[model samples]
Target: MSVELWAQPAMMSDPAPEQMMEHILKRVGDIPPLPVVATKILSMVNDPDLEVDDLVSVIQKDQGLTAKILRVSNSAFFGLCRTITTVKEAVVTLGLNNIRNQVIALCARSMLETRAEGYALEAGGLWEHSLGTAFCAERLSSTLGLKGTADQVFVGGLLHDIGKSILSYYVATRFQPILRLVDGEGLTFVEAETQELGFDHAEIGARVALRWNLPEALVDMIAHHHGPSRESKNRTQVCIVHVADAIASMLGLGLGVGGLENRIDDEAIAHLGVDDQVVQDVMVHMSSIGDLRAHIGIN
Candidate 1:
């Protein structure tokens, strides 16, 4: 449970990577904490007796967050016929959980909006890819009948690659060594990152999820979206994100330097009790990724 304890050891010949690992772990704390309002909204939604007015009161304290939520609520993203002018109206129209997704989505954007140029993602590329994965994961959970709030998988999918945002600087500085492991030794980008940097983005992402005090399932999803561990308790959620990430990459949402390098694991496919046809259907439905920027309100 110790976030700072990494499994990957630095190369024996190189003391530098150990230093880098220390530096990387220290940097994880520098990333800001999850917004208090967003966390409060998450807590309030879990209360069965929670009322619309209660949720509205918590959100209204932050004028900017409330305004953006209302904007997205009124957009074609929801396909509502009536306009939503107030936070209460948005809660009623979109439902409490949907409104919760908007808050987390925008908060996630603060971290994800950066260029993961280290991963060959520039400007808004990381955000686009993360949003697509979140939507895909949400639909996959529904199609598979996984029991959880819509907010959980959506948040999971959205933040899966968040480590890339934080690790970009290390990746940029150590690009040559990481690349050599991948191209010369045939290591996957993640493996190379772990070997060279002493941790990969997924591990860093797990730390972020833990630091934010996000749900355990979300921590697992972000930690293992690339390849779910066999021992993970939240296997369904973790695998959904793994498959969703692959589907997002396949749809060409945000290939970055990791483009097509990542593949859908057959075990994850089987674990979800789905065949290729279901995968194909999900892919087709997810093609609505075309209007993603509008859905997320990111220009």
Candidate 2:
């Protein structure tokens, strides 16, 4: 959704944070819609009978996106023996799932690239953090023997903090208080947000996903990425993103104001069956990748 959907809170001598959150929710309609191509790709990816040619046709509809797909297909990350010169060839070579993720990343780049000054993130900082989390989540998924869900976990990690983008305006207004709580009271970012704003970014992010008509599994992951949700049916995905976020923060990829203050959910790690060895392997792999921005086309 577009940043325009972030409604300014009403001017009042003393308005409750709950009231402010209600206003924000009502204005969700003002958010920009997802690119039609991205939405179509998401739908097709979930279809059991999706055809490669059908996906190729959809990618071809946008020449720029098609080129991006081909470029990523040939990037050093893929380690292709030859260049992929066409959408059909890229889809066949990279597989539909990888193509779908690339499209999602491209579509989300604009929105995620915005500077979240309220959260103390400089321009492109949030994007860098999100992309790092996407990579980490995908790797974690594979390491946990859930390779089939690597792409889905990547999307979950990519959009985990999206609520911050929407709530940034209000956060800017409440920044001082939030910071005070974080520094003085030793509260986590989510705790501070809930105490000062009557809601956390995770909750807001879930609403955003619902507004976009995203799949329920994705919505749940975005909603509970910080920890497990009793309401979430896909606990594994939620845990994957949760652990991935912790890993990203630990790596200091783009840790803004309260980014480093987050705690790793021990239960989530255990639930995903992630051991110390897995964590070690992920850290080493991340270091070896070097300049993830280039691999993800952020630059």
Q: Write the per-residue lDDT of candidate 2 for residues 98-124, one digit (tens) a residue.
A: 678788988888778787877888778
Model 1 clashing residue pairs (backbone): none
- What candidate 2 gets wrong by more than 4 Å, as runs, is 1-13, 46-49, 70-85
- The most accurate candidate by TM-score is 2
lDDT of 2 at 202: 85
Q: What is the C-alpha RMSD of each candidate to the true structure, in Å?
A: 4.9, 2.6
Which runs in model 1 stand beyond 4 Å of their true positions?
A: 1-19, 43-51, 76-82, 147-149, 296-299
Q: Please, what are the lDDT tens digits per residue for candidate 1 over residues 165-259?
A: 87787677679998999999999988898888788889888876777787788889899998888899988888988988988899888889866
- Displacement of residue 79 (Cα, Å) in model 1 is 6.1
lDDT of each: 0.78, 0.81
